[model samples]
Target chain A: MSFLAQSAAANPWFSWAYLRTNADTIRALVVEHLSFTVEAVAAAVVIGVPLAVLAYWVRPLSGPILASAGVLYTIPSLALFAFIAPFLGTGRLTVLIGLVLYALLLIIRSTLTGLSQVPPDVREAASAMGYGRLARLLRVELPLALPGLVTGVRLATVSTVALVTVGVLVGKGGLGQLIIGGFRNNFYKAEIATGAVLCVALAVLLDLLLAGFGRLVTPWRRERA
Target chain B: MNSFNQMINWLNDPLNWTNPDGIVTRLLEHLRLSFGAVLLACLVAWPIGIALGRRGRGGGLVVVLSNATQAIPVVALLTILPLTALGFGARPVIVALAVFAVPPLLATAYTGMREVDPDVRDAARGMGLSRWQLLRGVELPLAVPYLAAGLRTATVQVIATAALAALVNGGGLGMIVSAGFGIGIAAGGGQILAGGLLIAGLALLAEALLAWVQRRVTPAARQT
Candidate 1:
């Protein structure tokens, strides 16, 4: 094994040769990584937005709701996966659940913050203009809260991207599998570097995409800027 | 239920506590690595953070850079480092953990320092306090809560990520979980469950302890 590793070390760390041959594998991994991230963040938004709305409506529930989400975020990824794998099985489904759980706090907190920070006068004016409570929340509050919501989504998305690699421990690590494969294959630098680079690149790309989405949605803010 | 009972039995086992690779030894290793990483991160990040916060400039750049680092996976870093000159040992793991730890430490320290009330700072200046005196006497005290909060965040994150050390020949509770993985889950599932519980429990305990410290350090007026 040592001899093999020594020989592998002789291979260049950044090789077009490796890239060309492994292009298909890298593409598949990137797709898996992207899909997992999108699915997890989407699920988190679907679940978290309602919870945040509930917390916003019921003042007392906010504390417990956010606190519990915080607890979920605090659990180490590996431990969380291990704990859940028995019940959920070590697969994409388990990883998806874990990702969503980790993302809940960030999404909820940001959305709650965004909702709370809406100008009271704006809300009053909305009411005066015959907007009901639900209408005010849906039209006036949610739109104004777009920046904060976007920030939360960006944060959660980036974090989830990083975390998906940990899923490799359960055979669902997306790009993480390549990283581990590299390790077991005598520290194949090209494979490890590719996986790591792609992961970071994915994060940056998603963050920028979210930022663009935020700007695209908040046109009035753009004029001010 | 069976697995939970198995985990409990595993924890209760005397051999798991006293043997060479027992829980106690792994726990110590985890704590030591976590401490070293956080300390190193503090040493590297605090001075830069404090200076920037004091001057109240360059902080936006610092924040952006730190935020960028968040996207880099810890597991990837842990794996990559061992392939370098660092080789397989606690050093690479410590280095990776410290790197992961720096962003929170730096961000919080800068924010803590930057958040010092200008009025208080002006009063200190009016009293003819030197810059260093103002920082030590007024700013640092006021920033304690932020610093403590940052420390807590960094420490918890370090402790959590330190479990990845097992991937690179580093000693820690992760070794147990990975060991369980080495055998199949049917036979070694108890060890995996036990390891997860222990790791999560330790992280939560550290978080709670540090939160208490944060509360204590916060001034009465800022208690909320």
Candidate 2:
């Protein structure tokens, strides 16, 4: 056999047959990553949106809070994971906490930006119409800011998906297992191909989903198009 | 005299510098990895980013791609790449870092190009400039500020994520952290804390440098 064939034969992970045979495994991996991503992102939105609203209302704390989030963003994922592991222990919970923390900066920034983008005059007019604080927020400010908030969600979604892979390191679920296992076993082709496929597919799917959502939520953007 | 002597003793500690696996060495390695990744990413991403930006037809698509790429967990990517390539080292780490770097560069470049004032483009076209000339002379110059901002974001991200390279045994400041955590800090908590601070300082320095470069390169006209 030729050297290429020899190399391919030697590497189980790289074989087309291996990937084909492991279809069920790959699906499970993808599902786990997706579920974890969704969960973390949802948690982040829950925590982040309120903080964003409070920060926006308060104004003074926004800068500091956002800055601190920015600092958190700078902390490396592995290091963050390691740091939090001491307090949270290993597994999905630790990964979730880290992902949630990571998501906060982007979500908060976008939330603030979205809310602030609503014209002051529009807000004043809403108040003149006797809209209560909650009413004005839900009916006017939120709807106006929905596009940006959605953008933030879109960002958080992609980030969480990507981050869930990191969950593999802490003995949680996802494609990270495939990656880590493949590496430890010296399976180069399987490792590279698996990573490449997942990254590309996840990226494409997320873009399509977010674009669709953006269109649905922001008819004005569509009209402009 | 006793207080002065205590202060002097603190300054002379071996932990301050001379250890072979010192914080300074680890910090340098992390910075080196981050810089290597960013440079590689720029080399790969910039041309593509510029092309996509100039095209302007699929700006949203590019943004989505970048955002998605950015979102992928670093550990996951690191884990997979090395496995495919067989065994772990700096190459896989660099590849992971580069992959992470691409989205921001491409998105920002695309956005910058798209956000260029239509009037400016029209004026350039009106002056009988060809498409290539219009892109080089009018569109690109206008898009630089936004592009710089995007690069600034990418720079910090690359620096931060490069720390993950340690998980794969790629060796960087993360080694200090992971090793410290593995052994428990009582054995070397000082080393780990020092490494963490070093990483933080390097990140700050990178942010400052990139910001400075952005400010310096950006035209005075764009400053407002």
Candidate 3:
């Protein structure tokens, strides 16, 4: 039997030959996965922060805003993608929109909670120091809320990475394509393992990088720690 | 709009309910899988979390681990597991979902146990309550809301991810959606939309029900 046929029969979990042959495909998939994740999360933050600000500014809106996000979050990843694919035509945009919706609840809740946690006295101090509301929010509240916001970003980023794999159902599932493809390709164990491992590693690596970024931005936290 | 009407018409068809691969069967299968996974996860995570919480240690690790597990794509796990000797069935789906569920359940249980007010605990201890009495009477009651919240999160997550079971030859509502996809978009768009709608509706219903339960269980002081 040829190596491919032999490996298919044996179904080994690790095959150097498979990796060597599929290296370019795997690299492209990984890049696709990373880009999808980064873009989705960045978009979610852009949209989520303003919504969080709106919720914070208008106390009545908070309930509706958070509740809507919660509802969106409850929708299954597959269903969310399915719902949008008809309109978006089953590719990057559909996946991106679904991911942003999923990430919103986490980001909004964290940002709002972080902003709320900023002490009233500190706000008064900022105001007393001749700061306007926007200035206070930017200089005092946001600075103080950095840890929580960063934590939310990390959570959103990680979850987005996982959900991006669901895009495979629509032909945009980055590493997810490899995972499902391996399964359909005669239970190719090495391919499935490689895809799964890379996804998890990517999640962990990005989370750590975000954590580092969080620490770097909030130098005062370092001193306290 | 045309697709929406078709979806409505598809949902209304009597045969769709009574057929072998009908909505009712798929729904029941989905519910069964979700319930089993969540139950198994609770069994595995609750005891360990409670023990750690009571000790007031390992909470940080539990939190970190829980957050880390959020990164694990359920689809990947579902597909990867059946490749083992488990081999293409509900068994691997259940096992994968259970693993997916452990983190939130475990983390919440730990937090619930740890969040009991220290002063209340001290008062209970001073009143000559044994460790057992303290746990049962004081800590557990206070922890109910947190446990409920954790249960809610786990159930919702499991239900959503359980849809992927169809990919592994595991029975669930996912099979409906997958079947719809198999027929191609032009002919099967209505079926696809219907399946997606059903799954989304089921998940939302579960979320609302659990949120109500969480509210009911919470101490009145903590209702907000």
Give me the candidate number with maximum lDDT. 1
| Model 1, global lDDT | 0.88
Write down the DockQ of candidate 1: 0.74
- Candidate 3 lDDT over B1-224, as tens digits, reads 46677788889998997799899999999999999999899999999999999899997789778776787888788888776777667778888999988998888889988898899999999999999999999998889898999999999999999988776668888787778777766666777789899999999999889999999998789987
Across B1-224, the per-residue lDDT of candidate 1 in tens digits comes to 46677788888999998899999999999999999999999999999999998888988878787788889999899998877798788888889999988888888889988888899989999999999899889988888888898899999999999987776558898888877767767766788899888899999999999999999989879887
Best by DockQ: 1
TM-score of chain A of each: 0.96, 0.89, 0.97
Native contacts retained by candidate 3: 0.72
Question: Model 2 Cα displacement at A184 (Å)?
Answer: 1.2
lDDT of 2 by residue, A1-225 (tens): 474676666765456776788889888878877777778888888998898888988989998889899888877676677566544556678888888999988899999899999999999999999999999998999888888889898877766666666665466747777766565555555654585468557756875798798789888778887
lDDT by residue (A92-202, candidate 1, tens digit) is 898999899999899999999999999999999999999998998899999998888999999999999999998877788899988888888867888889999999999
Q: Give the number of colliding residue pairs in candidate 3.
A: 1
Q: State the weakest 10-residue window (summed lDDT) of model 1 chain B.
A: B180-189
Ranking 1 against 2 by TM-score, winner: 1
What is the TM-score of model 1 when looking only at chain B?
A: 0.95
Off by over 4 Å in 3: A1-4, B116-139
DockQ (C-alpha based) per candidate is: 0.74, 0.28, 0.73
Docking quality level of the chain pair in candidate 2? acceptable
